[model samples]
Target: MGLRFLVVEGNTRGARQAHKQAYGLTLSESYAEVLQEIEGGAVCDIAFPADEGANLPDAAGLESYDGIVLTGSHLNIYDRTPDIVRQIDLMRAVYASRTPSFGSCWGLQVAAVAADGDVRQNPLGREVGFARKLTPTEAGRAHPLLEGRPAAYDAPAIHLDMVTALPGDCTVLAGNAVSPVQAAEIRQDGGVFWGVQYHPEFSLGELAAILERRTDILVREGFCRTPEDALAYTADLAALHRDPTRFDLAWRHGIDAEVLEPQRRTREIRNFVEHRVKTEKSARGRA
Candidate 1:
């Protein structure tokens, strides 16, 4: 049988539309494309509503998919807004199903909260653009979730909140000075949760688009000198992402070639699809 997966969108219509216009794919579409490259299977898209008290997905209803991939969110998890609280409830359902799961940024934060962990606005502020040099913890070196990852690697990131405390049975798999819980693994009675504080699913083009949208914020946050410079910064980064041979241009723009390689940045998701998700499918088939 073919593999099947679900992408739980964390962005609303406004944010998802902007993402589509910039990256030529919606958040769910982008994730589906990435997974398709690895698993070449079906992807199911589901999302939370923008209304005041949207409830979470029913975990029992999620039995169809082999695994779930949680997307990043514009909503901060710490606020406990009705929608966010609902997302946490859905996360609990995900864990209870024992469904192998993977998430990023807000994904990590929500899963942390449901598992009795904590999340907070990083006093250091948003770690946008890049999660630079995330070194794997001792556990990360051996976890299948982190298989094939380098000792230290870079991933595109854009977040204001982070996991400050781990869940009841979770372990820190990867981290850096910017965020102490960059990646984690939670083992519960029924399911397993793996997450990253950065966007391994994001392409550099996506990062560039995000920066383009946030030029004013970046300037105000002291991340860029001027709006024009920020635009140019994204342009150059997007170009180099398309062609690593533009070493000189990349250098002028302050991009490290080693960190700019797409394969290295997307290693985590690749492992999830290839090792965990596929393995689960095979196991169930045999059973």
Candidate 2:
């Protein structure tokens, strides 16, 4: 039988213009779509708009699922909004039930908070587009999530809030100059959670769409010389992924290394599925 998984999307109910243009999907829907690509063989289901009117599964309901995925959000972890609070409550339940969970971006912050960690608005400002070369920690070097990850490489990212402190039991996996806690593994209430501050589930096409949606802001934040320049920057990322011989093209857009390696970008997501979730199925069969 296939593994059962649940996707708890952090976005609110309303759809965004950018998402509509990119895939005609609601924010939560798009997240589910990408997650489907990573946990490919699993039977996946989604719980949407976790903040409002969300019907979070009870403990028994959670146990039925082999894995749970938490998607990124615009909500700030420190905001204490009712919706954010609900997500926290859900995270707590995940631990109490010992459910295996994984997360990205806002998803990571929520896990950290629920696990007794701390979060704050990044004083370094928003890390838009991509986070580069998040070097693995000594622990990450041997971590299952970094099973085939390079020592360091870039991944799609866009976030403002970050984890400032982690639960005592949490092991930091990777970090870089931009974000101190780029990824972490947590153990709490008998549950295991793996999370990343970047979006391994995002495709470069999605990243470019996100950049286009935030074009004006990218210019205002001085991330680009102009709105047109922001568009060009997105195009560069696409180019890197498109051509095999364009290894040198990355430097022009601040992307280092020989070329854009798709595997490098999706290192964590594949590892999580192949190692963590699938491993559970094998263990269950043995039992």
Q: Which one is best on TM-score? A: 1
Instruction: Highest lDDT: give the candidate number.
Output: 1
233-257: candidate 1 lDDT, tens digit per residue? 8898788778878979766855564
Worst 10 residues of 2 by lDDT: 256-265
Off by over 4 Å in 1: 49-57, 253-259
lDDT of 2 by residue, 220-286 (tens): 9899998788888878766666763575666566664412555566777778778877887678769
Which residue pairs in model 1 clash with each other? 98-191
* Segments of candidate 2 deviating more than 4 angstroms: 15-18, 49-51, 238-251, 254-261
What is the clash count of model 2? 0
